[model samples]
Target chain A: MDIIVSQLMTGLSIASILMLVALGLAVIYGVTGVINLAHGEFVMLGAYAAWALQTEFGMGLLASLVPIFIIMAAVGWLVEVLVISRLYDRLLDTILATWGIGVMAQQAVRLAAGGELRYVQMPEPLSKSVTILGATDSAYRLFILFVALALFAVTWVIYRHTNFGLKLRAITQNRAVASSYGINASRIYRLTFAYGAGLAGLAGALVSPLKSVSPEMGTNYVVDAFMVVVLGGTQSLMGTLASSGILGELSGYLAFYSNDTIAKALVLLAIVVLIRFRPQGLFTARVRT
Target chain B: MSGKTKTEIVICAAVCLAILLVPVFMNDSFLLNKYARYLVLGMLAIALSLSWGYAGILNLGQATTFGLGSYCMAMALKLKTIPIHTGPDGLPDFMVWNNVPELPWFWKPFYSTTFGVTAGIVIPLLFAALLGWFMFRGRVTGVYAAITTLAAMVVVQLVIIDQQAYTGGFNGITDLAQFDVAGFAFDAYGSASYYLVAICLTASLFLALAVTKSKAGLIVQAIRDQEDRVRFFGYDVALYKIFIFSVSGAIAGLAGMLYTIVMEFASPTFMGVPLSLSVVIWVAVGGRQSLVGAMLGALIVAGMQGALSESETFLDSWTLVMGLLFVLVVLFLPKGIAGAVETITARFERRDPAPAQQPQRTDAAGAGTHHLESLP
Candidate 1:
């Protein structure tokens, strides 16, 4: 009973990370119809940002979150204006182009920061253990679980009631119609893209203490995030949230039963089968062809 | 052949001539060997172009087939070096290290050269056909196909790594002997290896050219450009996709075999996402729709990568340079380096534009990739 409860905690925590990574990707794909391959790099940059803040400037982890979000948001905006904006009409080219950006971002980080893995020191306050259901686990994992929930709630509020969200939804429904109604679709996209990027940064900041920070960290996250976005209908936030939960828990349970590598392979096989059956995604979005 | 096709062939012949003269001009055996290796990679680029550029199927897992081919050859070579092929306890050294008391079941057939050679090519082809059936049968095309291939690649790579006892795990199959065909031995260090690679490259190039320029090739291109229209015309779209995909896999497998011969080892790095992405970029940078362009693109890009990464000063920054180049090429030069070459040559020759630019430039299928998904 204790082991099962612990595994559930692990599954939920992993699910949170998956949802965090996919949040940005789902938003961008939903609004702009651009599958931004560089979404992973944005998360990577956020981790580096936290490392720099903690190591170089002596800022606390929570304190650096806002700055990292702002910096990464600006970077995301620049990417939109310079590269992604031009190739909006070409799906494959955007994929290739964004992939190029992803590579550049990775290399740029490597060249600037050096290739060695950097650690983000966990704050002293949360460095203790907590017990629940007769199981002992680190407080940091519980902290991460809370942060993930907070992020989801924050994202939901932003999408549900804000003017930016309204414009984003209008644009998604019909860009031309939205423009005629005096909503600048371009501005909405730029801001939304940046916002999405900021969410990725936030996720990175939250998860930095748990994993080693490196230039290639984004690549792994991006692959998982892509799977999550696809498995959930790409256009539906609720679907993204649910699918991430399903996959994260599935892998978590499988890993406990077997090994990590076998669990990963089985997950991939499951995803491939899933995509084959429902190419559009888990939930069908109502849209005009 | 048409004049444009003839020009493409002539340019490829010139590249072959340059490679052929390397041993004569440069006494450096290392450089000569590197050039041979690049030629083999160039074959891979052509295979990518055949499926991606010509058939409009972006098979991101092209490297998987190539790596499988390399493993096939490496397994055969590893078996030959052993004193015996049978007995449960007579395992390869690595398996012995892993405490396997017997030879694994899969490693048995590789003891025969014929089986190895045939299996190397056919396995990838069959694999592609099976994958294509799953993908195209479900009407998965474009970005969907790309994602599926990428996922499949990760799965295959993980499996290879996990089964370390049988596959030698991450170290992969190594310490291979010079490749032999029946009784004929091709020495790795000698000129025989170079000639072997050169001949295979030339044969593969011709084979690709023949396929792309044939009547069936035109239909395949048509399918890429106008899938719905072609389907309306009463053709099996999935059949065309599967055929081209399988052919591409065969070529990639052959390239893998040559890679094993030249490099004397096979590793999972060859089948991973990064290398696979580089192959796509090479084809895109070379001019995706042109075979000769794709081959030259791989050769040039790989050659530069080698020189840059090897030099002490640029070693750290070469990957950054490559990424920047990739982005710039994707954005401003969508037609690629080869496209520029083709345009310039066409202008110099001042050929009849009417014949060159036929009226069949169907505007519908020419969207850069896809303008947009349906709006909600």
Candidate 2:
């Protein structure tokens, strides 16, 4: 029983990270209608940026987050203006183009930082494990859960109440109609893309402490996030969150009993089956083409 | 044939001959070896083009099929290497270590090269057929199909990695012996292996071309362009899709056999997602929808990677360049290099006056009169 409780906590922590990553992917796909295969690369860049700041400048983990987020957000904006903007309205091309961008980013990082795994040092507070309900849990894992909740709240507020969010919703529903209403679709796309990318950057920062920081580390999470998006239904934040939690918990429990690889494969197979049965995903969006 | 088509055919033949003669002029055994690797890659690309270019099935799990083929060949080689019931536990060395008493029943037939080759093609095809039937029969298309195949790739990779006793885990299978065709010994590392690979590639290409020109190929292309319309016409869209997918899988398997022969090793990386994605890039860069374009694309990309990897200056940035090229090609040339070439040549020919137009028009009309002369 204690083991089950501890495993559930671990699952929640993983769900937190999955939610962060999948949220960014969902938002980007919602507004731009682009799958953004480089979304994982953005997370990777964020992790690397944080790693560089800590190793090179000796900055604290919290202090490194802000700068890394800004840098990654800027990169995202530049990518939107330069490459992604040209591939709009063509989903296949967008998928291919962003995949190329992903490869380029991954290879660039690989060239800079050989294929070795680098560790990130957590703060003293997060370094300790906390005892809860007769079970010990990593403080860092608990912290990630809190951070994820806070981030989710912040994203929800921004998406629902903010003017930018309003414009984004407008653009996503009908681009031509939104433009006719005098909303600059391109401006919204750029800002939302950067915002989504910033969230991915934040996700990378969050997961860096838990997992080894490496150029190809993002490869592990990319497919899972895509699965999350598909399972949740594209462009639905609620759906993303719901699916992430379900998958994270399912995979964690499976991993607890079985091997990690089998757990992952089972989750993937589940997603395929779910998509086959319910193409619109678990949570259907009201807006349609 | 008209003088223009006849000229095009002659030019294509000349190019093929030039490629064949590359080993004659290149004194370096290393260069010849590299070209041989490219030829094997070309076979895989040809398979990619048939399924993706013509059928619009963006199969990103092609490496899964390729790996299946290679593993079959490797298993046969492994079986040959082990002595018959000499070990402590009458089992293959790796299986014994993993605690299996005897060879897996499925792997038993792979002791024969002929059976191994057949299984290599048949297994992937059977898998693809089942998968295509489930997905396409239900009218799944576009991104859904892509995701399904991608998932299959992940599943296959995980399975391969976990079944370490049988598969050698991440280390994969190695030390495969030279293939014995009838009574002739074809060494894996020497010129004989290269020649074997070349012959396999050429034969695979010809078979792929033949399949692409068949009636079933036409139905597959029709399904690609208009699935609903094809269904309305009383055609079994799922059957056609499965057939083409199976053929493509077989070709990929054949390519895998050649790949193992040339590289003399097989591992999980050979069937990983990255290799699958690379096959997509090969088809795209070569000009999807054109067999010849796919062949050239694979040759050029694989050949360039080999050459560039050798140079210190190009090593670091080669992947970046390849990625950029992928993006550029997808954006600028949607039909790929072959389509671009045809478009360019047609434009140039349009600019020039036609000396013999009436006969060509008559021939075109006559060809059009046929319900289906050849598959696209």
Candidate 3:
């Protein structure tokens, strides 16, 4: 029972990070209908921002979160306006273009940061270990889990009850009809894209202390977040939350039995199998195509 | 033959001749070895073109097949080198280091040269067939196929990295012997290896061109243009996709085997994400629709990479330039360098239009229009 509790705690922490990353991807893909392969770069940029803020300005991770979010949001806005806006309906071209954008972002970071691994310092207070119900984990991990829940709650409220989300959903359902209804679909897309990017930035900033910061770190995050979004229905926010939890738990449990690399492989294989059977994903929402 | 096909054959012959004459003009063994590696990469570009261009299947995990072929060849070469490196145990050095007591059953078959050569192509072909079967049968198209294949490739990379005893972990298979047939040896720096790659590339290029021009090739193109419409015409769309995918896999495997001969070793990075994406970039830059153009794109881009890396500043900025080029190509030069050549040629031939090719332009434009609506 204690082991289960401890594993559950570990799973929750992993799920929280997955949730944060997938939230932005799910939002952008749901509204814009383009899978932003460069979304990973956005996360990487966020982590880099955190590292820079800490090293140069001596800012704590918590204090730099808002600034990193804004920075990444602006970056996302620029991407949407410059490249994604033009390739809106061209799905394959969008994938290629975004991948190019990702490569450029990675290479640019490598050049700027000199391709060496940079570490972020953990907040002193949150660095200690905490025991709850016979399960001990870093306080910083619990902090991450709490922040993820808070973000999800905020996302859920925005999506469910806000006017901006209504417009976004309306456009998602039928772009022509939404435009006819006087909704500025393009502007909504721009904002949503920015917001999603901001979420990914926050996730990256939070994760910087845990994982070593590098140009290629974003690739793994992007792949993991993609699996989460893919497994969770693409357009479903709640589905993203649920799928992350399931995947994180599965990964933690499998890694407990075997090793990290094999666990990852198995999770990917499982997702592929699931996609083979149900391409609509595990928790598909009823939306008009 | 049609005027277009005649032009293609002439171009292929010219390119092949130029490749064959590289060692003659550049006597430096180092340069010859590098050119040989580029030739293998050119073959990789052609393999990508077979599927991505003609079949409209953007296989993001193409390196999986290529890497599989490389490993198969590497394993065979490793066995031959084992007698010299390790004791009478006959195990790979890495295996012995990992405390593996006996030779794994899977490694035993690779000892025979015939099996190694055949397995290099067949294993990747079978793997691709299985993957293609699942994906196509499920009607997974466009980006879903790309993501699935990408995930599958990562899984393979992780597995290869994790199984340190069976497969070399991270460092990859090294210290391979020269690939030889009976008494004849194909040295990396020798004219024989360069000629071998040149011939293989030329043969594969012509064979690919022939496939693209055949009736089934036409049907494949039609499927790319309008998949559902072709299905309504009573064609098994999935079967065709699987066939082309597997064939592309086989070609990639052949290239991988050739890569081992030229590069002298195989590593996990051979099939990593970046190399796989680079293959796509080569096809995109060369002209996905043109086989010769894709091959040249690989050769040119790879050659430029080798040249540019000599300067420290250029090394840092090369990926940025390529990335920018890729983005710009996707936006404006959708047909790439080959497309530009076709455009110039078309203008010249406009005064005397070929009746046979009147609808080609319209067909491509129509396909573009269809693609926007069909993909979600």
Name the top DockQ candidate: 1
lDDT of 2 by residue, A148-263 (tens): 77887888888889998898888887799999999999988998889889989988987888889988878777788888888888867788888889888988899988999999
How should the candidates be ordered by TM-score, best one leading? 3, 1, 2
Model 2 / residue B18 / CA error / Å: 3.4
In model 3 chain A, which range of ten residues has the least summed lDDT?
A: A280-289
| Model 3: chain B TM-score relative to the native chain B | 0.93
Off by over 4 Å in 2: A285-289, B1-15, B26-29, B84-90, B311-313, B354-376
TM-score of chain A of each: 0.96, 0.96, 0.97
Model 2 C-alpha lDDT per residue in residues B92-185, reported as the tens digit of each score: 6667767877778887887788898788788878877888888877666777788788898889889999999888889888766667788787
Q: Pick the candidate with the highest lDDT.
A: 3
lDDT of 3 by residue, B1-376 (tens): 8988998999999989988988877888888899899999999999999999999999999999999999999998888886875545888888889999999999999889889999999999999999999999989988889888998999999999999888888989888888999979999999899999999999989889998999888899989988999999999999999988998999999999999999998999999999999999999999999999999999999999998999989987998999999999988887789988987776566535655666677568657865885663
TM-score of chain B of 2: 0.87
Q: Name the docking class for model 1.
A: high
lDDT of 2: 0.81
* lDDT per residue (tens digit) for residues A1-289 in model 1: 9898898888888998999889988888888878788988999999999999999999999899999999989999999999888887677788898898999899889889988999998878898999999888889888877887787788788888888788888888889999999998888889888888998898888789999999999988988898998888877888888988988899899999999999998988888988888866787665213
Cα error of candidate 2 at position B68, Å: 0.4
Compare candidates 1 and 3 on lDDT and give the better one.
Answer: 3
